[model samples]
Target: MTVLVSAAIDEDVEFERVWLDDASWVDVARGWLVGPDAVHSALLDRARWRQNKLWRYDHWVEEPRMGAPARHGFGEPLHPVIPKLHRALEHRFGVALSGPGVALYRDGNDGVAFHRDRDLRWLDDTLIAIVSLGQRRPWHLRPGANRFAHDLQNKGATHDISPASGDLLVMGGRCQVGWEHSVPHVRHPIGPRISLQWRWTSRRGHPVRGPSYRAPRNFSR
Candidate 1:
């Protein structure tokens, strides 16, 4: 449940800021993990991943990725790299973080579609940090569509982020609510990629905002 970062952390870690529209921001940090190859291999063995279907267009569709969640709290043992990664981010961001799960993309067909993280809508402010491993794919983000700003979904305008092994990518501020991020399907061959989402769990006790939401028309590229 609680993540700890030891003082003898690696010194090679460095962060780069990428600013986006309407004050949104993304932080990319590289060289945080001492041995990324070992970590990635460990995940492949230790993380018991599963795949599910998502309800879209009133039909059940494959979720496009396999995930192995570590439950809500830190009651059980996690893969070796998770806690260390969280602690590193905690030291840098100065806040406690919780990772609900990691999404594993096996290949080009495995990926997430366009959708804002609903958890962010529950909080006024929070952060979602992702630590990447294995493969490099385009993680895209763009402004959420509204009745008047439907043109904002233009594919040419999406922010394309490619995080390699041992890299940390953080999305904070109002980014989750104001913008949508996704890992698009690649057209060519590529190795597997693992993305660990370290997020602040939304207040579970907050009242529901309203009825469930539907993705905007043309939300897909």
Candidate 2:
């Protein structure tokens, strides 16, 4: 049997629906990358050895958190196919990204809670590109109000994106600031899924500090 594949498009030209009237959330833009299946498989293979994290909230009154691995700088070469895909998005949105590609693996009950990617040290007002691969799941986006209130009154809409084998999601502008997003766990049996998130950071040339490196003792203490 022959499998039908869909094409990816840039955000500007793709069909979109606003989730929250007050936020910059949009949905239903299909395949925005080389191919979701191809990228998904690649990320799954890479993540087999790489570690993953559970998202956390720092404070009681903090916003919902989505844990992600530290950004991996571009000093390491990216898969050749990724550059072409990245460039396509950059041209579409007219924004240049920096370095460190992020890949996420959600298996079993693993899921990402509602949140935004605005707090990165190097992140500015730029678009964050995401390519989805594997089993289809729901991605939710909502306005960022008081944590409690937002979680309560925020009937924030959701997009049950069935991003089959290959699909992409590009979020930008006030989207990051005005809204929060997430990939909730599904009850259906889902095979391993991989998502590649591309973004640029301002802190490129910074040095690395090992875990053993201790801070200087505070004499005042």
Candidate 3:
């Protein structure tokens, strides 16, 4: 697996466009940031992490990891790295990437199941940027819904992106509507992973569904 990821990195580390289907696609940039490990360490030490949960069938279920949308909602000024990353993304993609959704996968047991960015589906086209940090993990995508999984070989509709630290993956076009993606749960031992997601919104902004939190800096009355 490492070899495969390495080969992709060697072949292209900047703006390599990959077509997942006729409508959805992704842009992969390996090692886009310098010293991603250090950035991960800093985030672990400073970012205000929060537990997440989902409302399903009139009941609540805990998410597999701790996360927060710190880069949105005017909650607080983001870490210095956030601004730097925003600038880089704007320059590379020429789009205003906003509304961060950061997730910390503590280990193999912690991961998100297959799903789409349904919240951003209001538009015809959208972009979602993900900056991977710490520990490489297989990120998979499959067309339509609920068909992305390990037993995806026979389905012939699944593909994966194993991103190393500092790597960037951008899902664009009708990806949210036409494809489902996942970071399947692992049983074996593995290191932690932090996914920095900067998703799209209107030029102004919009409301999102999900449990909210008050950051460490919250001072509202």
- TM-scores of all models? 0.77, 0.62, 0.76
lDDT of 1 by residue, 1-221 (tens): 23322222356767788877655789887765556666676666667788776567547667788988653336554455567667778888887887646778999988776666674446435689887878878888876654235445535336777788877789876676677777888899999998778786345334336434333222344
Error of 2 at 6 (Å): 15
Q: Name the runs in model 3 displaced over 4 angstroms.
A: 1-13, 69-79, 145-151, 154-157, 201-221
**lDDT of all predictions, in order shown?**
0.69, 0.52, 0.71
TM-score of 1: 0.77
Model 1 misses residue 191 by how many Å?
1.3
What's the residue-level lDDT of 53 in candidate 2? 34
- Whose lDDT is greatest here? 3
Model 1, position 118: C-alpha lDDT score: 73
lDDT winner, 1 or 2: 1
Q: TM-score of predicted model 3?
A: 0.76
Q: Compose the digit string of candidate 3's lDDT tens values, residues 1-221.
A: 01111111222445779997786789988887767777677666656789876665456677789986554336543355666677777777678877567789999889766667765635347789998989898787777754634365624346789889989999987777677778877778999899888877442333344433221222246
lDDT of 2 by residue, 84-124 (tens): 66677677666676533554545547666666664443223
